[model samples]
Target: MAKILVLYYSSYGHVEQLANAVAEGARAGGASVVDIKRVPETVPEQVAKNAHFKLEQSAPVATVADLEQYHAIVVGTPTRYGRMSSQMAAFLDQTGGLWARGAFNGKVGAAFTSTATQHGGQEQTLFSVIANLLHFGMIIVGLPYSHAGQMSVTEIVGGSPYGASTIAAGDGSRQPTEIDLAGARHQGELVAKTAVRLFG
Candidate 1:
């Protein structure tokens, strides 16, 4: 049974939704196990007391041991100022010990993200996640242009040649479009299949 870790940092729920879609795709492609982990919030003390702000639901904190048990890892994040959120970055930074030990060497890696606007730096966020995988010597996988949604014309709202994505409306209440969901699933399946081929 191959296990894939779906790890992410999401604010306003968009990225979490994308992560779920990615996991669904991985499962559809016959991955035996999928674990979803969320990075913890890190708001300043002054802002923590604000009524408008609330602590994000924290997923299980991933340890170096956790990385060792997985055949592949799929990372997701919301776009933050043309980059991945600092929480996600901090999570990756904690993996320095794993990198030093070559714990992820040759393992499969993939990324996904969501943005508040159509042009809100989804690609940059994906690449930012990919960069950390590279440091760990993990092979990066991405959604191919061959996916059906990629060729469709009905407003491709999410996913890309880089990885999975979603475009939340300005108000942040809009769910991902069906096309976006399909693309995310495709990305998950592709990464799972690649991991199986490479490591199984």
Candidate 2:
């Protein structure tokens, strides 16, 4: 019974939708406990409201200590200039204590993200998240080629061997397509399966 946490920070609900899909796949992959949580928003309340940020998210705010309880942590965030959003980075930065004690040394870690365009640095954002997981001594799980959907050239899709991703469009109108959500699910399931085999 592996415990998996789908941790994410979504500014426009794009990544949130993918987070939920990831949780669903984790459950299907035999993880008994799958929790979806979001990091705290660092932007000022007024600024967030003015920017029309999605403030009505339902996931509870995750604390640094929460990372200790999961066998695997699947992270999601929106891309900001070829990297992860500052909100997600700030939250992960607080995990220095966990790194010092190797609290996550044997855990499985995976990443997912959303971008504003096809070439909006989705892979770079995933690498940024994976880099943090590596520093924590956690094993990295990417959206592997086994997903198959990542190779599709039929439609405008968001996925890669690095991780699952979605194009949110410049105006924040385009939502994640079905293929994007499927890739996220595949990555989450793989992460959970790896954790179960390694930790259980």
lDDT of 1 at 32: 85
User: What's every prediction's RMSD, in angstroms?
Assistant: 2.2, 0.8
Model 2: per-residue Cα lDDT at residue 147: 84
Top candidate on TM-score is: 2
* Per-residue lDDT of candidate 1, residues 89-180 (tens digit): 88788887778888899999999998888788999988998988888898999989866685666674777888988888777778887888
Regions more than 4 Å wrong, model 1? 44-59, 151-153
Predicted model with the maximum lDDT: 2
CA lDDT scores, all candidates in order: 0.82, 0.92
**Ten consecutive residues with minimal summed lDDT in candidate 2?**
147-156
Q: Which ten residues in a row have the lowest lDDT in candidate 1?
A: 49-58
* Candidate 1, number of clashes: 0
Badly placed stretches (over 4 Å) of model 2 are: none
* Reference-based TM-score, model 2: 0.98
